[model samples]
Target: MSSSPLASATFWLLLMNTTWPSHVHNTAPTPRGCASRARGSPNSSCPRQRRSATSPDQFVPRKAASYYDLLGVKSDASADEIKNAFFDKSKKLHPDSNPSNPELHSQFVELNEAYRVLSKEPSRKEYDLKIQHSYQGRQAFGSTSGHTVYRSTTTNDNVHYWEQFRHAQSPEATAEERKQKKKRNFRLVIYCVITMVLSVGAHAVFFRKLEEVHNSFMDEKDRAITELYNEAKERARANGFKKQTEILRQKHADFQEKPEF
Candidate 1:
């Protein structure tokens, strides 16, 4: 059957809506780079997403030499050994010996720095403690990497790069360290005194109790012995009195019988 113009238009609109793809309506517009990528173009100037700074691949492992390594001595090397190593290296790296070489001159400067720290007992101990606690210091000194770089900076820089690793203690810092040491020693002495006092007090109480028990036992024994001695003496005296009375009675009987005869 033939329909009216309005009815035909309405039917056509409904058909078009039903036939359209659902994704075309829902999808957002593609970016220019995405469109280029979809076209498989090689010359597209699309920027790639950069890797994160914290990504493992972004980190390049670097090995650095510690002062001990620079001096060619072990970390646990004695003061004498460190001094001797510095002297030996100094002879080779001295500016006068290698006048033309700038590299040796730099090494001589490093050698002097190492000697200045390691030659003294206080600075060396402090450096050792720092290396033990620091991660970079441990990696530098602990690792056996073949390519080890020693960090250096120009003298114009506010602080030398090596100074970051080891620097001379300020007078204030030295005084503070000494103060801490004295405090620790004082605490240790106080602890010892407290322990000694407690021990002596415990011993005195134990000994006093022991003496009281011993005295009580001795007094009881003495009382028992005295009672036994008194009982024995009273029995001996009663027996002697009975014997004398019997003798007197026997003598009187004999005298009466003689007078009657």
Candidate 2:
């Protein structure tokens, strides 16, 4: 039987996932048993993965992750303390450090990804905002949700910055500060927990919302796909079963004809 367009697209995505080992990102440890199979090409060392922009979610991302979280330090941690933690984790997971182990290798890649974003001042700030946005998304659902996967976050610089702000006389504060005063919000942590619940009902609700928006955006495209599928089946019935191209063209022509609706 002919499949639907959305189903075809989903199938291809899954096939790509299975075919390309590195394309998949495992959240946790997985066995690295396949060597040649994992590489999938004659020249195994060839760079198979290209840097692509990540997909944008429907809602606007919040400014959630603070510098302390980026550096994985306590707000009160000394410079030495922060340095020690970063180096220790970096060394253990660095790709070069664990060449043979895929789990460690992936962790190593993640550590570097995190480090590059966190190390620079401007870049770090941008990343923190993105993190915060993600956090806010999760926290928005927090009251009933469970704990988020949290990393330690307490940095000396952050501690010092807050301390200075606290000391600054209220009368002399900057205009930006006056416009948007700082207050702690812990909603992301709640969202993080909610995600883990694997609540079918919760996901059904969320995806239903996505479906509503999706239907609004591409209702015509959806109808076209369904019509195309129906036509293909009709063609299969009309033409001899042996000829694929003939059936496809017949279906194609049928779809182009205006429907009464």
The best candidate by TM-score is 1
User: What is candidate 2's lDDT per residue for 22-96, written digit by digit as tens?
Assistant: 545554443354443556676455345554566465456433334456457765565455445666776666556
Deviation from native of the Cα of residue 173 in model 1, angstroms? 1.9
List, in order, the clash count of every candidate structure. 0, 17
- Model 1 TM: 0.35
Lowest summed lDDT across 10 adjacent residues in model 1 is found at 156-165
lDDT of each: 0.72, 0.58
lDDT of 1 by residue, 149-248 (tens): 4546676222433452354323344467679899999999999999999999999999999999999999999999999999867876776977757767
Off by over 4 Å in 1: 1-169, 241-261
